[model samples]
Target: MSLSIYSIDLAKHSFSIHGEDTNGNTLIHKTISRAKVLTFFANLPPAIVGMEACGSSHYWARELTKLGHTAKIMASKYVAPFRTGAKNDLNDAVAICVAVTRPSTRFVKIKSAEQQSILMLHRARDNWVHERTALLNQIRAVMAEFGIIAPKGRHALQANIGHVLEDAENQLPDLARAILADCYDHLLSINQRIADQERCFDMLVNHSNNAQKIMKVAGVGPITATVVIASIGKGEQFDKGRDFAAWLELVPTQYSTGGKPRLGRITKKGDKYLRTLLVHGARAAITNIGNKTDRLSLWCKGLVERRGLKRAIVALAAKNARIIWSLLRNDTEYQVAV
Candidate 1:
């Protein structure tokens, strides 16, 4: 089988492919409908195909592989520099061609159906959680204008609403109390949705071997485990533990001058949602169980004292990403050194 190189630009209704080889020689450039993309590739010899990572790109990549062609998915940002002239399908396709063949460029890993399914779960749960928070904040803010303050948390809302309403000596009028009562009911409804999603997450991570191994670390639990697993897809893409951590944006941002390197704030470069989950889990470990005397735990505990809670959580999250990367890469159990 011989290898041919081509770039593709995917759009809503149509697609374009720009074929070329090294030494700046053009081979084939044509537009095809979405329905015909697979058929067109099917006739071509087994070759290398490059496309930007976007919606449905993964599915197409899988299809291309089935047709015996190798697919390289590059981030759109990386492909932008190779684009010549206006940003249209042809130029974009050319950009992808240049980007994929670049030795220094990074490619996206192919995700299996199971990995995609788990990620769907994460997206659904995250949406529900966000909706819940938005409503909770609105409820609190609305109540504040009426001089009615619910307790600090959702649990406190029910009890606090009752207490404030029952106090005849309070300044809130009947209408304000009635409004607070309705908002509390709405807040409770959102809480129920969150609980339901959490139950779904529990069922998800419970069945996965990787998720179970990851949860063994101090800063990880069921939610964190699933998010990390889903976001990483297959761990084969990462070359090292720090590579995985850096992908999760767990590492400190880098700056160097005069051969002296300095670290600043976290790069926070990867998936924001996954990073947030890891940081949250790290916080839980530090506050509730960071002093277990294990190597990582002790290190995290000391970090909390030295760097304060927020920085400590970010640091531990980075460590946890590295540990996860190691676990997946080496296919070994996590050992807690005391």
Candidate 2:
């Protein structure tokens, strides 16, 4: 019988696939090279296809979808439980087949080429920032060896570096000065690269209507605005604003039994980069909310007085996540609560 469903365990150069008939009987099982995957699927009757959401899974999903197959990307954890025996490509393929048929299984949203392109820019900027921080920390450690203590914080270190290098009274040797100068020069170059990446983000934000609409919320700047738009796309998968926020892991986690509910801290389960940006934006909004009578600002002050600073900042971020969902899902502008 022609297979009614299929699961693929993907690899760089090869793949393992398991197919099942409508009665849940195994119909076909085989290994094929990566080059043959699409051609094989294109010939097969259109059916449900499942794969783990890793590596090039999104790219494959998009491709398969173009071929009329309903491709579903499952997180590895969810598929792990369905493995019947020892781990192998065959077992993993079978597991994916089983997991995809389950009603409760959560699937990853397939991202477009443009979405992945935006994410590439974000990841590149992150790498440059990490390299910059490492260089700065190395400079700080080298300076400390000479018994010269620069005050804490990046701004302070930048302000004190020139003075430390210029002062002869610090008794810094020539070789040490040369090494530090090299580190400082590299640090400046990395900073310029980071600035250039931010300019790219600004250009993306200027061209995206969704980015502009979301930025109307107080805390969201260009980076946060563009990231949210890139990450969530149209937000059609989420039925409500809270569902979107929960996906971002901004909602409180729950542990309940015996008809009782015990809620714990926020789940922190979604994209770490997006969540961090939202939190940082929230903190900035909190810092700048000085005696403003607007509903958001007034609410922020009251929350600060009640739950204190950190909790209030998180609460605000969660609120912003919900608002972000509303804007993206409905394609509407943000309206302040009056």
Candidate 3:
């Protein structure tokens, strides 16, 4: 049978595939074991294959592309509207099949193995940081139970924790002191791991031309630069900087009626990690923009004065996203306007 398009509902062990002909008639709908997936597709003629952007979807897409098929991955939300009946693997496969054929559907850009590896490092670092935060909070709460209070910041806690444990006159029981000591040790270990991950990011940024270029922009550090490179290689997937910013969901949400435009706060719908990094970076840039007369700096100064600090931070973040996109898309250096 001549297959025109194939949609796959991917899973750990089994995958449901829906195949259609040129006339949109369903030709094959069946579940296959993981091991046989590539073999099955390899046997068929090269065709357009679609899958939702979920865990392992990129791997499958890359594998399908290797078999001469045009692989496309769409967001799960985009595929949801195309589902006709009850939700299941087969129905999802059919929905993907239908969604892939639509011109308006936006597909995910496939990440290479190297990109995935960098992102893996990022995930590891982020996880370790969260673990450290939880450990800090737990330690503080336990200490507070015994009428002990550590200072406000992590640095203060680190500095005073040893003193707290060593002081014999405090309310902390021997057992509690031991436990708190253990917790502090664990926090130190987590901090070490996070530092190691950040060093890895630095090494990656040093090697990547794209990372280096984006890092030239204000508010973008090694972490942000490496993540952007991993997430979107050259930014070619986006037509313009504004589209890239919108993809990051840094743009405002819109609700228009009767030709009246109504815009609300940012959609905040895409990768929260990326959005957060950008915002934090923007905040840092704004804090350090002292008496600079450059065009970008002046604009940021004006924005902060006109819109207040919080909105200014977000606007600067969105602006940084656009600037990063432009640098990556054009393969050029960032120029500070006078």
TM-score of each: 0.89, 0.95, 0.97
- Candidate 2's TM-score: 0.95
- Backbone clashes under 3 angstroms, per model: 0, 0, 0
**For model 3, how does the per-residue alpha-carbon lDDT over 1-338 read when each residue is reduced to its tens digit?**
55499999999999999999999888799999999999999998989999999989899989999999999999988899999989899999999999998899999999999899989998888888888888888988998899998799988988888899889999678899999999988888888898888889889977888888888899999999988988988888899999988999999988999999999988758988999999999999999999999998999899989999999999999999998988888778998999
Ranking by TM-score: 3, 2, 1
| Prediction RMSDs, each to the true structure | 2.7, 1.8, 1.5
Give the alpha carbon lDDT tens digit for every residue of 20-122 in model 1: 7655689888888988888888998888999999887888889899999999998888998888899788888888888888898999988767778778877
Clashing pairs in 1: none
The residue-by-residue lDDT of candidate 2 on 193-238, one tens digit each, is 9999999989998899999899999889988888887788988888
Displacement of the residue 232 alpha carbon in candidate 2, Å: 0.8
- Residue 310 error, candidate 1, Å: 2.9
The 10-residue segment with the lowest total lDDT in model 2 = 1-10
**Most accurate candidate by TM-score:** 3
Q: Which ten residues in a row have the lowest lDDT in candidate 3?
A: 1-10
The deviation in Å at residue 82 for candidate 3 is: 1.9
